[model samples]
Target: MLRNVATVIWDGVAPFEFGVVCEAFGLDRSDDGVPLLEFGICAPQPGLVRTSLGFGIEVVDGLGRLEEADLVCVPAMRRGDPLPDGVTEALWRAHDRGARLLTVCSGAFALGEAGLLDGRECTTHWKYTDQLSARFPEAKVVPEVLYVDSGQIITSAGTAAGLDACLHIWRQEYGAAVASAVARRMVVPPQRDGGQAQFISRPVPEIDAETLGPLLAWISAHLHEELDVDSLARQVLMSPRTFARRFRAETGATPYAWITAQRVRRAEEMLERTERPVEWIAGEVGFGNAAALRHHFTRVRGLSPQAYRRRFACGESAESA
Candidate 1:
């Protein structure tokens, strides 16, 4: 249960993300008779902090305030800049004293820089996924999900996703009912399971009106079929090389990658809607075997097929038995 929370601020901090954290924890919510959170903004200098959006905020506390906090939050920062030396040291001290560390959006960069996320599952805004993964390979970077809660450390995706993460923390500490009440007071959805996808770039395929649309429709309807690029090319009356080039140009992904993504999408739908055996679901998704299905599903979804099914399958038996 978190009663005391502190947010660390620096120059160039995003105003909107910072405000989200403040609204979640800093506001006096005792009017509704809910347990009020002790929240305040802390800076290294204890003065006006300039925001990314050309405004200055007067903060009263400094990094020393974090020592008494049960939870510490760092909001988004400008991409590709070194965090201030004092802020880094303060974060390290707070973590050493057993504060639950949290980062929203590019704040993960700060955590990653401090090496707090090493070997932990985490995520940030999808736009920074590649750079974050490259910078912190030791940290398992899960790009698609809204947030990752790895016990003492948590990281969330872009802007609005931070709201979901904060609500989740409230739920875990005070139970869903209290969290729901807080959400109603705040006028937002009470619970958005952290496993929900973040903003993903979707590039639709382009084919000549004569051939492409129908071919994609066929592939989607018959995912159980073996969809080799050579065979698909033959269906569209083009050579494999030409077909592969066209597919990549249109969809911004290779044929194999696109097919694997679609198969995983189908598997996700089935796992949510049915209680099929993992092996059977793998076969139906054209993965040939459960192992291959698990491989690709984990690659895209960050969870094994069995785990995904368990999370979503609603307790029904396979084939409605």
Candidate 2:
């Protein structure tokens, strides 16, 4: 459904952030049965654009191109620089016309300038989250996740997180199979939420091994087993209270939260890779029964297990749904 994507660039744009946007949408992957996206770069002045990294990229497209885009992405810009004439107004028009909007890192400031973020749940780079909050007092700025998708308007954290945000849109619009294929092409995880409960079932892209790492691996290996705060605390050689505190401190989540996420993640994999019945998958993932699994899966993913499998399952047999 999101066929046309236009990325807006301007003076002082961060190159890496811009490239993340380009890599996410600008590449051709239809060879893998993914839709070929119509991606382009647009600039307000329609010529050479200066980057924060001391280089210039020649952009041939202008804001006029943005008018027809299904989605408009803005990359990180000079934190406090002036927006070019008509840039902010164009963003407003895009939003007014129902175009999807996405921002990476300090690109959020551009949305803030257009008054799009006010009263909407959004996020930016952790370093700039406070500043974004201070600048746009009405916007709900969530500082701790890989990205935030408040429906049509999506915002991501710093750097590679932009990839996650883009893939999220892709998964929603097309399906998980398409998103996964694109991710494999990019060599990045299709989804990662950094242990926040809201982004349930999505794994963190990667983690460096430590005391918490071994615990996480153990939990993943035994998701169907009863895993409670007290039981896990004993494994870690600490009191339940201390274990909860330490888990949150190290992983940004509580013991119960992590285990629940792990179970949901297992459900997702089974739903995608196997044709097992919902009741069977639910019990295997430790949700105990279909009713309980539906409650948590719907609460977290906004879709039921059957619907998720129908939409995301991998092969021709998956079409049976």
Candidate 3:
């Protein structure tokens, strides 16, 4: 049902964030069975809109174009800039008429200015979450997750998290098959677990393939085996403590957390690619049993294994599952 999309831009809008919306919905992909969207770029006026960088983009339409949109997108913009006339009012009218509102990174500040985020749980880039909350004390800000979906308003973290949110909307509206196909075209993961906390700035020691990179590839190949810190340490000729430190420094995740996330990714592929039973997938992915797989899969994906397969499996594989 999310066919029409209107992306509102203004002076100081980040070009990369604005491009995220255009890449996700503006391009034509009907040959891949993905629905084509009626997408447009709008500004406060129909003219050149200056970007945060040193350039400008000519916009063809004005805010009036948002009137009939099914989805309205606001990409990252400078937090201190004043909202143009009718910007918040137009957004309120769009939301009131049941159009979903989405923001990328600091763009959530506009919604805060509009009072739409008051009493609603929302978030922005981690660097700005504290500022977002401090500025709009009534809004509940969750800083850890990649994105937060509080009903009609979806706010994503910095940079590529916007793609994740867009794919999420695609999965919800069509199915996982379409979302995965679109992700394939974009050359990014179909879905990713774990929160953006892993991406926060950290001082990592200098590392190379001689360190944990090859070990990671090995772990992916042997996921069904028991992969504990002690066992992994022996493989790399280091003690458990040294290996654990090196692993976290190189990958930004503990061995257990990274391994479990990979196992879940493998399980997801198997569930979609083969009509295999959940118990078999559980064993193959190191979960050992259907009950364990169901617990972890549900916890990570927000849906049960059976439900995920039902939502994502393709063609005859889908019907059989």
Backbone clash numbers for all candidates listed: 0, 0, 0
lDDT of 1 by residue, 12-34 (tens): 89998898898888877777656
Model 1 lDDT, residue 8, Cα: 92
Model 2 agreement with the true structure over 1-321: per-residue lDDT tens digits: 799999999999999999998988898888988888899999999889999988899999899988999999999998798788999999989988999999998999989988899999999888888999999999999886778888779998878778888887887777666877889999986655533532323244235523566887888888777788888889878889977876876656777776776677688778888888888888898988889888887766778888888777876585323
Candidate 2 structure lDDT: 0.83
Flag clash pairs in model 1: none
Evaluate residue 225 in candidate 2 and report its C-alpha lDDT on the 0 to 100 scale: 78
Worst 10 residues of 3 by lDDT: 193-202
Candidate rank order under TM-score: 2, 3, 1
Q: In model 3, what lDDT does residue 36 have?
A: 91
TM-score of each: 0.63, 0.86, 0.83
lDDT of 3 at 118: 95
Query: RMSD to the native, candidate 3?
Result: 3.2
* TM-score, predicted candidate 2 vs. hidden true structure: 0.86
Ranking by lDDT: 3, 2, 1
Clashes of 2: 0
